[model samples]
Target: MQFIDIKAIHAHSAAQIDAAVAQVFEHGRYINGPEVYELEATLGKFLGDSKPLHCIAVASGTMALEVALRALSIGPGDEVITTPFTWISTAETIALVGATPVFADIEPDTYNIDPKEVEKVITPKTKAIIPVDLFGQLPDYTALETIAEKHGLKIIEDAAQSFGAEQNARKAGTFGHVATTSFFPAKPLGGYGDGGAVFTADDQLAEDLRAVTNHGCKERESHYILGTNGRCDSLQAAIIQAKFANFRDAEIALRQKVGARYSEALKDYVTVPKIHPGNTHIYAQYTIRPKNRDSLGEALKAADIPSAVYYRKPLHQQEVFSHLPCAKKSFPHTEQAAQEVISLPFHPYLSEADQARIIATVVKAV
Candidate 1:
């Protein structure tokens, strides 16, 4: 009945996690220990490239985004276009780096930022486009990359929700000028605590990201750029490595299977998730859009089945972004999605009995 079965996930890898943590404790190098580097290397291998992508582990997903912006020198007088339908961190990080966040409407079908809308928002001030991989599926990166190349803009792929996902055989973190993913325990390839990593193929940018995460020092006692304390703890890295062993081997396929079942059973009752061509989804949340979303939620609650909304209000309508021009602009798709989207209880380990119960409740309610 839980929204995400964290306990069940942990139980699946308890012994491996325990051993990893015990090793970290024995070494007592809690910050930036050997395990952190090992995890980063493992991550790089997971998201393969002809030349291995450099992965810089950081304190959290927010830090990874901020570091990416800072390394790219995107600041005041610059604008970053991103979807307003995602978690606040996607846009807020742009604002935090002294850049304006220009809102782009999402595609109703994918609930991902519309590349067409992105093109419309580009002004002289536009420096980068942050395409978020919403609900564990990538946005139209091929189109976005073409746009970025035409305009000479950077693309920062926000893959926090789609770490294990794939598009055209390329992994989630392999797109964009630089990409970032979260390990917030709830993510597909998550750690025991808050953590994230930045990915890039450019050697210089990789070096810059490493420095940015470590007080701007390439070596001890020398500061090259303005930076913050954004280092990931060794303990978190160890936990992620342990879990990743299983996550890559079996958990991703299990998630895909569960997601397919939900879509197959619920498609007639509601708007099930739409998997774009050439993309493989991990279903971080099995979200659906039902006309009577609120009523359906009530019915599920009455039936003792759990459900939740990913975002009840689009970022354009949020009070914090009111001063921005986009805050006043109408985004029909984003607004409609806010009113209709609801996520059912989902996890790789969701029992068949639980899945059936959830589907029956939803079908009846809708």
Candidate 2:
């Protein structure tokens, strides 16, 4: 069994996708075409906002974070606070813009950037906080936002894994000063290829992001500021729009049902994931903590049931960022989680039989 059944997912909407791609070919405007804007609008509405919230399509999730930082003017000599446990892109984007990524410890339960740790790391040089919504759940934004306001820091919600997640009535991509989501095929609302979107309620920042994504020019031959070619192609946008139109809601429901089943069946055998109050988890990866993660992973592999790890090492311990400026202490919780976490085969389209088999294997392995 595969960890993510991409073929099975696309099979459900092949005809609609074909028609969308065919329309894109007929238009022949591959870069920054009509489909890109249509998808931005569609996703903006999907996030439950249109008037105030603006979406800018980018080339990748990393680009979305970079563009958001550029639009916010975070640059060299500036410090951006973030969690130690996440994909490198979360911290890599900060360094890409010549800014320092200050590492913060995470909350053990949610495995997200801890607000208290974030507060402790705040300095005059601190410019922003990029809190990742790890494993398809939104971070503790209530405390994070309050801390940002007190410190005058921008809150950049890294919703790369949480496209369909929600906290209270607000969606994942609708949080903080700006929020970013990925369409890297494995994400909750993913495209066939690399794509991402940046969201913000600030009108000027939204306008700046549009310019930043297209060589810093709103009009032809007119340059205003430094930017990159981060525009999303029409073909990928068409595929994402088609997939989102038909399967987004139903897929979200299926993921919830799947997550619940895993939690119910495996809670006794392993440490299942936890959802924060008022937050709806999308289960991008149904990760659990078995007593012996390595042994459990080996057993699953032996049984032909695939499993993976979101992050085996926290960002602070990574070789690339080891010498970078950070807190002069250890992250006990983040370190412990890196050793214990294991993601089982999880997808919206995973069959009941497959799930049962996975559960039984995990129970026996542990």
Candidate 3:
């Protein structure tokens, strides 16, 4: 009955988590101590990010994006092309770094930024392309990669919702010039507190990020670059390291099974999430597009089942950003999805009986 059964997961790993915390206590390093680099090394090896990659654990996913853009020398007068169908942090990071965020439309089927539409938004000042991996599904990177190469633009993969997902064997963690993720508790590989990391295959960029996140220090008292306090806490690192041990291939396969169950049970009533031919969706949200999204959500709620909307409006329509130059209603698909998308209660721990109840309610309502 829980929207996301974190309690069940905690019950399964309480002992391991306790052991991790105890080790941290024994070391007496409350900040970025041994636990920090330990997690970084493990992640680096697993991500297969060549010699240049130096994972810098940061305060949050938003921090990761901000630092990544800074390392690229992105600033005022620069425009970064991205979709408006995501959390505000995606665009906020761009603006915080003094860059303008240009909006692009998304595909109705995949709910991902359209590569063709992305091309239309490009201009002489375009600096980068941030193709978000929305709702645990990845955009067509193969197409986006080609566009980036042609335009000489940097690519940043917002892998906050997709940490372990793969497309043709290339996982989300390994692609893009810079890939970022959030360890917000709702994410697939989250920790007890806010956590995030920046990944890249550039040695200088990694070193720059390390300095940027720690008061711009090149070393102890040797300030060479401007930076901020963004290191991931030692306690958070320990807990995440322990959690990483439990994350396995079998667990990823289970997500697919759970997604399929939702897809099969509700496709007749709602538009289930679509998966690209070579990509494996990780089911972070298991969102669906329904004709009567609000009424269906009410029906599920009335039955004591939980349902919510992923996004009620695209970013360009929000009050703070209305004045930014954008085509008048050119993003029809993005606008339409805002009114029709609904996220059902989906987690890896979902049961057949619970899913059946939820699906039955949707069928009855629609």
Candidate 4:
């Protein structure tokens, strides 16, 4: 069975996707076309609260984070706190923006950044907190918000893995001062190619983000701040829009069902995902922790079942971040998780027969 089954997903909306792409081809406005704006508006409405958020589509998830930081003027000598248990992009963007990334330990249960650890790391230099929604469950934003308010720090919610997820009625992309989500083909709400979007309710920040992604120009020949070519392609936007119809209507609930089944069957054999109260997980990975993760993976491989690790090493242990002070600090939970966690084959389209096979293999192997 395929790991993510992107082909199966595409087949569900082939007609709509084909028509969308055909329209983009006919227009030939490959960059920042009408479809891009349409997608941004639609996403804004979907993630909006009392007010619709302003969505700025960008080239990639990394670009989305960098643009948010640049718009907030966070750079050198400023420290940005984030979880080391996440993808490198979460911390890499902080460093790319000339800010120091302070490592915070993750919770053993949720594998999300621990807010209490986040509070301990705050110093006078701390300017922002980037809490990643690891494995599709949101961290404690309620507690993190209190901390941010007390310290005058900005919260940049990294919802790249939990785009359609929710916490206490608030959507994932609407939580922090600004939030970002990826459309990498593997993400929950993926596109045909690399794409990402930033969400915010502040008008000025939204305008600034738009400018930052377009070579820092609000108008045709005038440049303001330093920026990059971070604009998302029109074709990618079209594909995302087409897929989003089905994703919003059915896929999110389907993922919940699939994840529940895996957790129910595997709970006795291994550690299943722990979703916090009032939060809905999209199960982007449906990761589990087994006593012998590597051995289980080998068994699954022999059984023709695909399995992968979200991260084999935490960001603090990465060679690129080794020179930083936080790199030397011990994060017991993050370290232990890196060794034990493995994601099984998961997607909204996973058939019952395939799921049973995967479950039986895992139960026997573990």
Q: Which one wins by lDDT: 1 or 3? A: 1
Tell me how far the alpha carbon of residue 238 in candidate 2 is from the true structure, in angstroms, after superposition.
Answer: 0.2
Q: Residue 67 CA error for candidate 4 (Å)?
A: 0.6
Clashing pairs in 1: none
Using Cα atoms with residue i matched to residue i, what is each candidate's TM-score against the true structure? 0.99, 0.98, 0.96, 0.99
Give lDDT tens digits, candidate 1, residues 23-98.
9999999998999999999999888756678999999999999999999999999999999999999989999989
Reference-based lDDT, residue 57, model 2: 91
| Span of ten consecutive residues with least summed lDDT in model 3 | 245-254
What's the true lDDT of residue 120 in model 4?
Answer: 99
lDDT for 112 in candidate 2 is 84
Whichever of 3 and 4 has more lDDT, that candidate is 4
Residue 123 of model 1 has an lDDT of 99
* Candidate 4 lDDT, 1-366, residue by residue in tens: 899999999999999999999999999999989999999999999988556899999999999999999999899999999999989999999999899999999999999999999999999999999999988989999999999999999999999999999999888999889999999999999988899999999999999999999988999879897778999999999999999989999999999999999999989999999999999999989999999998999999999999999889899999999999999999999999999999999999999999999999999887
* Number of the predicted model whose lDDT against the real structure is largest: 4
Clashing pairs in 4: none
Worst 10 residues of 1 by lDDT: 44-53
**Number of clashes in every candidate structure?**
0, 0, 1, 0
